[model samples]
Target chain A: MTVPAEAARRRIVDLFLSSEERLLQRWTQLSGASPGELRDLYQALRTALSSEDGDFADVRGLLAELSRARVRQGHTPSDTARLVFSLKEALYEVAEADGGPEALRGFVWFSRLVDDLGLYTFESYTAAREKIIIDQTEQLLELSTPVVKLWEGIVAVPLVGTLDSARTQVVMEKLLQTLVDTGSEHAVIDITGVPAVDTQVAQHLLKTVVAARLMGAECVISGIRPQIAHTIVTLGIEFGDIVTKASLADALSYALSRSGVEITGAARTRVAVRAERA
Target chain B: MERVPILKLGDILIVSIQIDLDDQSVLALQEDLADMVVSSGARGVIIDITAVEIVDSFIGRMFSTIAAMTRMLDAETVVVGMRPAVAITLVELGLSLGGVRTALNLEKGVAMLEHVRGAAG
Candidate 1:
């Protein structure tokens, strides 16, 4: 290890092990990122710092460009998490080929962030966004779903977009996290937006709602929008007593009204909308 | 773009805009409307924006400018037929087209202008 780089690594290790309050406080300001997430960021910064070549001044410019791209795209909390995860993974892949002690040490922090902090993958980011659509549909005060509390209560989130095994797992985790955050009782997951649901998507959603119910939250599944729903039913994939609503709105209202929130005005609009569809 | 129309309902000049109502389009519309108000000698101006689905924050900030132009030209202005969804979206998107007199429909918009003039007299 080079003198200064090794010293820097030793300092980071000490700060991590000693629970340095000042170091923690300073990192808290930069991104307010989770501790493990911050560790990932630090590792990413280390990679950018180490592999950076050419003019001594060029490193700042490269980072500036990356930051601009992030800002332009409206990077959210989840976006930051996925970015750190990718950077960590990429650094480790490169480190395996190069096999330098300093680079490997940097890889260690990034890998630890993923392992210890429960950070998700890039594909998981897409899955979360797709799931957020379910959140959006639930927030709608549509006819089938009556009360305003549907947005605040336990509701089903159908998976849409790509749910590779990696992201499917993250979606399951976030669903449980959101159930806890919202304190909703029932969550139904419909897999309509998912390009297709294999055994994995079905299994992931089932596991997620079960986890929620274990936490005293009820779960529902709706938005099994037509084709996807038909496919699952045809496959004889019994969803194990998981309530299925035709749509998210239907599921949300059923969940809320059962919880004693009367959804009067919303029901009429929902019917009227359906009648108009006919 | 040239997609927006500068229509005339008798002495009332109606400036109708469409598509995303951002700063560039608003500036172009305001400039054109000002010229139309001057050359056409309009006594009233009706700005219809029912077609706009996405309005940028900067577009909302141009309202007072258009309002001031109408006043200087001695032509009263009324905005007509902004859908509730569009309004809510605009507000949520943090665009406030404040001080622009709005009505439910074109008829109500015309009525508003007449009402304002009658009150003035």
Candidate 2:
């Protein structure tokens, strides 16, 4: 620890104590941190400066914790970083008290330390936010690929969003496991919620369908909108004898028939009544 | 010699693989299955693999080979009750086991062979 002169230490401490209220108010306004939080953070910083270690570990640790809390509280990275840098304002007034070359060198040293701390807080804030984003993405992937039993011998997987390889693997495993558990013979994959279907998405669908076939359950892919149909044709992608339908209802009926359940009476009467009306 | 038993259930030949197949056992089974199909005059073959766990490319290829050979002997082949993990490994290993019919269980497999025979006749 490079001991600053006793006069300089007393001057810095006195300046920090006098401007404590203003510093706290500034940090709270900038980071949306409560006044109580600012007081605890300032208290830690004061102890770090006065302690024999002189490493500022306590102050850095407090700033890291504050950075994570501010990130979770929806504060922007720049705002969170400002909370650390704002403390330098009170320290700068103390640095300005000495006009000699030695005092100027000491101020520069302290400024560099504070700058590094501010940069550390910014990095921690971004890292914390990135972790939150990745966690939510994984959760959304799981939530989007749900396997539902539509009938006694049929299961349906309704997929939304872009079909990436990771998502397709999850979809395949979940659908295949459900098929085994329920002993269902047919699986209908409805992509009605998918925003757009490209060649990669088509390949993912094919891989999933082929995997399901290997597990002994036939797959029916439904929900081909007009634009997707146009894209499929334009890309010259071959689905190769796989049954496809424009809607989930058509796929359900096809699956029902494949399972030997004839949808006979009500549908037939409706058709007959429509013909009679015509 | 560890021989995988091939049981005769009426007109259908049931080959339930209860052990992990080595190269020699697999070959012997293939030769035996072909001979049995010819001697018993079975119309269908159901190879149940529910008890077996690991299926490398060799096993996967053997399945394809058996299915093809059975077809030549005027018999349909249905591989039944494949575990989910085995299926995944097979697919990841790029073995589709194409031209082989699969069923969820032995009962469905037999029923499928019957349905195929009935449709053919």
| Candidate achieving the largest TM-score | 2
Best by lDDT: 2
Residue A66 Cα positional deviation in candidate 1, in Å, after optimal superposition: 48
Regions of candidate 2 where Cα sits further than 4 Å from its true position: A1-35, A43-61, A98-103, A159-169, A192-195, A266-278, B1-56, B69-76, B83-93, B114-121
The best candidate by DockQ is: 2
Q: What is the C-alpha lDDT profile of model 2 across A1-278, one tens digit per residue?
A: 35555444555555566667766776566656578877987888777766776668877788788888988888888888877777676556545654454545555555676799899999888888899999998998778888998988799998887777778777878888888788988999998887677787787677767777887889999998788878888999888878998899999988888887766567547522111111
DockQ metric, candidate 1: 0.01
Clashing pairs in 2: none
Off by over 4 Å in 1: A1-278, B1-3
Going through the candidates in order, what is chain B's TM-score? 0.84, 0.98
- The 10-residue segment with the lowest total lDDT in model 1 chain A: A140-149
Candidate models: Cα lDDT each: 0.58, 0.81
